[model samples]
Target chain A: MKKFLWYFSVTLLAIIFMFPFVWMLLTALKEPGTALVLSLPKKLTLYNFKKVLFEFGFSRFFLNSLIVALSSATVSTLFASLAAFAFAKKSFFMKEYLFWLFIASMMVPGLLYVIPQFLIVYKLGWINTYWGMIVPHLANVFGLFLITQFMRQVPDSLLESARIDGASEFKIWWRIMVPLAFPIVATVFLLNFQFHWSNFLWQLIVAQSEEMYTVPVGLAMFKSAHEEAYTLEMAASSVSIVPISLLFIFAQRYFIEGITQGAVKG
Target chain B: MKKGVRDNINAYSFILPFAFIYMVFLFLPFIYSIYLSFNQVTDFSDVFGGLSFVGLKNYLFLFRDKEFWWALVVTLYYALIIIPLNIVVSLLLAILLRKRYRLNSMYRTFFFLPFVLDAFVVGIVWTFIYAGRYGLLVNILKPLIGGIYETGFLGNAKTVMPSVALAMTLKGAGFGMILYIAALDGIPKEVYEAAELDGATGLKKLWYITLPLIQPVTTFMVIIGIIGALSAFAEFYAMTGGGPIVYKWGTPLGMTKVTGLYLFNHFSNLRLGLAAATSFVLLVLALGLSITYSKIQRKR
Candidate 1:
């Protein structure tokens, strides 16, 4: 009886969790007015998805999102890791001050800075460009803080042994620390990808042309179109949702571990 | 001294990229925003002009702006409503899933799917669900609530904010559940075992033991909840585009145009100075709230 109840609740929760995606799929398959009912379609078709991807240029937007997410993750991780190393290993004047400043910046509501950041992007003539999105985000305080905490856990003896073998600091970091920190690197990459991929306001502010629009901004614009085109909008929504959900499926362990670590060390 | 200087140089090189970008982008922009808040400029082109300085006028204007105050009230209302709603529902769900259960990981992944979703995507999906006419909700309510047939949840002034809040609350509660589940796992089993020895079970054990233990995690969730509610932009932008008009249930976004959305609009139109001023206002509000909340937490 207990087992049966458990299974029932599990199935129910899963259904509830997947209701929207199922709705999106059903909506996409339907001829417009048919979707107005919650019932399943008697027919299935791929027209809405095709129209969104081919006719509406969703493919370009997806590619743009992929490029931005990948580039931001790679560049920001590299810079953040290097900064994290400095904070973890070195004792210098204002080191504590700098670290604290960065930590404080993490808590600063991002909305407050969105406008200022846009202004900076404008002044640099980077509006509607890749560099505008990528540059400001390169200094990720959370990434820096997380990496620094993880790097501090590395045994100093390992680094000393490498030094005794005449390894340079860079070499030590590249060879020893980098491999040991793979879990964190993966976490940071996934988190950053999740953040940058779903970033809307930034993309909305900086990306002028439809060609440059990322998925979130693209989805926003798509939803804002004439109200009657709900089928196509749902199709576009599913396209964005599927990839990120797949990403989480693959990286759920790391994402959970990262948040747990943040709480423990925080 | 020379050797120390060499180490300093190496450190500087290590920190250079972060420092340079932060100073140029974040720090400088922050200062410039404060300056812009004091000056008046009509457009982006006029930003560099020698415009007359108007001290505290923008802020004063914001104070008198009924829409801004309404936005503030609505925002607080939304935060107050959603925070407890998420905490209670997530905590209960976390407890339900905490025991030995088949398909546990599967259930977790499914529940957490929404947090990973783009808010814009969720907005699109929920818009369909909440559509005024021919929407799933309307279809369901047509037979039951006759008057509700014509009234879309988001389309109606009375229901718009609450309906949006409900959607967000549903989407967000899942994430809080994940966090609480993680926290719940750390709670030592002995505490429960001890409670059982005293013949406490169910609600009694939960209130006396479990709630106290998870207080820290609950605090963290509350802070993040407030920030999340206040910083909410994508869903509102995607769903309502601010609003049809500020209703009784209107959000800050509906009433005064949230700073984030306003920033996007103003900057897109090339009104950079006013955008900057608006940013400063947002910054002050956020800072003030954070400090107030931190103080409240510290006292607790």
Candidate 2:
């Protein structure tokens, strides 16, 4: 009886948690102007998806988001890894002070940087461009912290052996440190990817033109513009969510590890 | 000494790329924002060209602005509700799911799935769920209850903030759950066995042994929750657009206009100095809470 009660509650909570996504998919499949009901649609169709992707120009937004998220994630991860390797492995002047300064900056609220960052980006003629969407965020202090933490645990002897082989510092980082730290590096990559994928406010501010809007900004604009079109709106929402959901499903381990490690250790 | 010098050169070369970007983007902007807060810029196109020294005028104006005060209240209200709801729900779920079950991983996945979603996406979906007449929740509850939910949760002034808080809590609870679960797993089996040897049973064990052990995670959650509440913008922007205006003291104010949204609105309207001032207020609040958090941690 106790086991039965436990199973019942867990299943109930799961259903409650999943209901919104299920409702979204069902609504997207339903025809436009249909009554909003709890029951599943009698006839499922892809018309709404097609309309959102093709007619509403969500495909363009999708591509833009892909470019920005992928580029930002890859670049940030690479930069963070290089910097983390130096901090973790090398001897340098003011190294501890420099790293602590980076960590301290993380405590300052990100909101404080937005206005000034916008001005800087605008001055550099990056507004309405991919650089505007991606450049300002590449510093990624949290990513640096995560990678540095992981790299410190890497055996120094391995790097020392490589150095004995006359491998330069750049090659040691590229060929030795990065491959050995692949797990944490991947975690940072996925975290950064997810951040840029759903990054709404910064993208909304920087991408002034409709043409440059990423998925989150585009979907927001789409919803406000097409408020009454519930079916199409659900389709747009699903389009924005599904790819990332699929990524999460496949890379569940990294995502979970990254989130837990990021919070717990910090 | 020579090798140490070479090490410094090698390290600087590696660190230079990230350092340069950090200096240009983050460090410079931080200083510039503090400067901009004290100066008024009249032109969007030419921010520097139109600058005038306003000293403390912007900060003084925020102190006198009713909307600013209301935004702060709404932000506090949001934190008050969301922090507890998130902590309780996530803690409960973590304790329950801590041990293995028939479908434990599936249950974990279902709960954590929403965390992967963008806040904007969750907001839009919940907006539909809370829509009047045609909303899913309204339709489900109408036959069982009444038409009281016709305007739905987001449509009314009184219910809007709580409704937004509920939606955000549900979306974010998964994150806290993961943290709590990890912390729970870290507790030794001996701790529970010792508690059971004492007169402690289920709830008593949870209160005496479990909660105390998980206090650090709870503290972490609260600090993160406070910061999240202060900086919360996307959900409000998506769900309420910071509105469903309510009249108080003969002045119209947005029912859900938290500080982050207020800052965004000001920045959007080209009120640069005021927006910077609002951000500074948020920054100070966040830093103050963090300091208090660290102080408490140290005391414990």
Candidate 3:
């Protein structure tokens, strides 16, 4: 009886939670209309998707987002791991001070970096370029900080053995620490990818060219430009939803682990 | 202790790539933003040599600016509601799902799906749901409210802030839910079992035991919630475009212009110095809130 009650409440809540996505799906399948009502399409079709994908060039935006998010996540996670290895395992001069300095940077709201970041990219004439999207955000203080905490848990005896066996410091980091800390690295990578993937404000500010737009920026622009074409806009948002939703479904463990670990340890 | 400067140098080499990039992109720009905030620049074309410094005028202007003050109050009113409501809702949901029930993972995923989504998507979809005329809320729930259909909250002067705040709260509650679930999982079964033996059950156990035990996670969530609330931009942009109808709303506040959106508008208008000052003010508030709450969180 208690189990039934539990299931009832949870399932009810879940329906409320999942309703928007379902509505989006339903909206995407229906024909464009003057008024959007919540109901199953009388005749379902892929016309909205076809229109959004082909005419509005959301496919290009998707690819742009993929390239930026994928490369940015990889590079930032690698950099963070490399620095994390140093902080976690090495006895470098001013290591504590430097690590704290990085952590302190995390407290600075990302908005603070926007103006100067834009200016620097503009100065270098990198605006509306891939470098403008990717390079400026590679210094992820949170990623470095999170991975450092994870790396500190790696047993020193293993590092000692690797060092004794004539492994160079770089080799040890490349071979040992990276492999052992791969879980946290993956977690950080996924987190970073999500940030870049859904990033809007910076891309909106810097990417004057439509060719450089990421998915969120494209979706936002699509919303305004096609305000009356609600079905087409729904299709654009639905396209944005699929990748992240799949990422959440498959890799939710790592994502939630990273967040909870932040609460407990970081 | 085995000590060679050589060993340290070798370790430092691993950190060099990150340090160089961090310095140029993040650290340098941060200092430059402070410099830019002191100047009035008409054009961002010559970022270096084109600006004449206006000293504290930007700061002073913002202090005297009614619209800026309105944004701050709306942000606070937005934050004050979102922080507490989200913390409660997510906590209640997490605690309710503490047991290893069937389909709990499915429930967890459904609840947390919003956190993973772009706020743009959430805002857009929810805007559709609250579309006043054709919205699900009106079509489905109108009878519940005696069929009184208006612009709903999205287009109202009095209710737009809370209306957007509600959507944001729902989207964010999932994040805190996941954190709370993790904290709940770490609490051993024996403690709860003992409480049960002592005749504490249901609400008694929750109030006396669960809340106190999960205090750290609660604190962490609260601090994060505050920062998230203050920095909210994309949602307001997507949903309200920063206003529906502007009024003083009884608190010297307009409806929905948040600090992030205000700063964003300034940036778009090429008011670079004022934008920088806004960023500075936002940054200081964020840091202050995080530090204050985290300090209190650690105290217990």
Candidate 4:
């Protein structure tokens, strides 16, 4: 039946789509030295993940990633929301010009900024420091831009009422704008969180010490350094894969919408 | 009407905190990079000491740098393949899933799952898949074609970029599929019903209705894809480390060293002048292509 064919095709595609993740689990569970030819786990063990955690310092890397990603996403969202409030609701001279300048600056590829920024950071003695990992990226223009777009839809009458109630701009932003824009900001926060979680290049450059490496950079370093240790490497990546998959499952709706909005508007 | 000074002060206060830091990290770099491109600094400390103006020496040097040209070619090849392939694959998947069906959301989530994983994580996963002698892909294909994929595609110089490109396309299609699905859902059902009433067949509806309606989304995806291809780094670092050198016109070239890695190499060596120039050139190329593409689209 045509109906049967439809379900069959979709189910097949879904399985194929999930094949790598399934393989990742299988590979992670396999005993060390298990042949790649063995599609199924042979005497499944957490030995590989344990090796990565204990020997390769994956726990340290995960903690570092969590600290950096959590702080950066939260701080960046706070700053961006404040700025977005001003842009959306306030009357300021040269505001349009200045905002355009900010947006236009984004057109210059981020690669162009790395060298100079690194030089400046080095001059300031921030290299190999957590400040190196966190501060330089806190003002992501995309986050500001996304929050601004969401804030503009916030009814001006609501803000006017707050003003009439003698609420200060900061208080209004905290009390009213915060609640009103909470949904979008939450979405953007998670997006930024995932983004920082996956940040490999910046983390790679900044982390001179193995102790400082974030999850992505640590996973990468683990791979190249322990080249033949396929099972261990698979386990290391599974660390990232598991959390992200869980994130996708729990926040799938926001991610689906947030990612799409960031795409089309961005 | 006379504007109040209070509004201006309040606005500046709110904006300056971010604007100042953003300028220090972002805007200042934009200008300094251009200046750095014209000056030589051999060490990171020397960058603080002073920059010796060399005019366009770095640019001239880059012009003759075979590695840079090869990187440019590799980038172009990636864009040429990835841009179209990503858009088409995602678009086809979107069209297939356009109709409301059982487990549609599950299907979409599965498709979009790979995109949620970081590029480096995905790269590691693919490296396992491409692990020459001990690869899932190799194991699966070995029975059909004996030893052809014995070592795996990533290790082979000729196949490395293509191999990376294939992995990237597979992971990347999910992102664009979400974009297309959203775009498709936005198209009014009345429009389709009207088309059906007009005797517009399936192919006709797709060509005249779906394609044209989603043209803007397509353009946006292409521009983003082009920039992505040009600036590809994390995955390459994780997957290839920009290695498995091939002899391109007798020059030892990294088969997968796209522009991003090329710049990273320069940065690591403290060749700030060259790195700055390369970034400038790439910035221009990216912005130029984006402008040109948009202009072309506007004209049409």
Best by TM-score: 2
Candidate 2 residue A105 C-alpha distance from true site, Å: 1.6
**Candidate 3 local lDDT, A219-262, one digit each (tens):** 88888787788888888999999899999899998998888877
Model 3 pairs whose backbones collide = none
Residue range B230-297, candidate 2, lDDT tens digits:
99999998999988888985799998899988999899988888899889888899879877986888
Poorest stretch of ten by lDDT in candidate 2 chain B: B140-149
lDDT of 3 by residue, B1-300 (tens): 356777787778889889988998989989999998999995556766789989999999999888888888888888888888888989978987887887888888889888888898889988888777677776777766442356755877666777787888778789889888888888899999999999997899889988889888777777776777677889989899877755464444447878888898898888889999989988888878888888977786
Q: How far out, in Å, is residue B104 in model 4?
A: 1.0
Candidate 1 true-interface contact recovery: 0.65
Model 4 lDDT per residue over B173-230, tens place: 8888988998998999999999999999989999999998998899888788878987
- Order of candidates by lDDT, top first? 2, 3, 4, 1
Show how many residue pairs clash in every candidate, following the order shown. 0, 0, 0, 2
Assign candidate 1 its CAPRI class: medium
- TM-score of predicted chain A against the true chain A, for each candidate: 0.95, 0.97, 0.97, 0.95
Candidate 1 wrongly placed segments (more than 4 Å): A31-33, B46-51, B244-278, B297-300
Of the two candidates 2 and 3, the one with more favorable TM-score, higher being better, is: 2
Tens digits of per-residue lDDT for model 4 on A117-210? 8877887899988898888887878778888888899999998998999998889889988788887788878888888899887888888899
Q: Per-residue lDDT of B3-107 in model 1, one digit per residue for the tens?
A: 888888888788888888888776776676777777776544645564568888877876676565665666777677778888987886787688667678888
Q: Model 3's lDDT to the true fold?
A: 0.84
lDDT of 3 at A185: 88
Give the TM-score comparing model 1 with the true structure, all chains together.
0.94
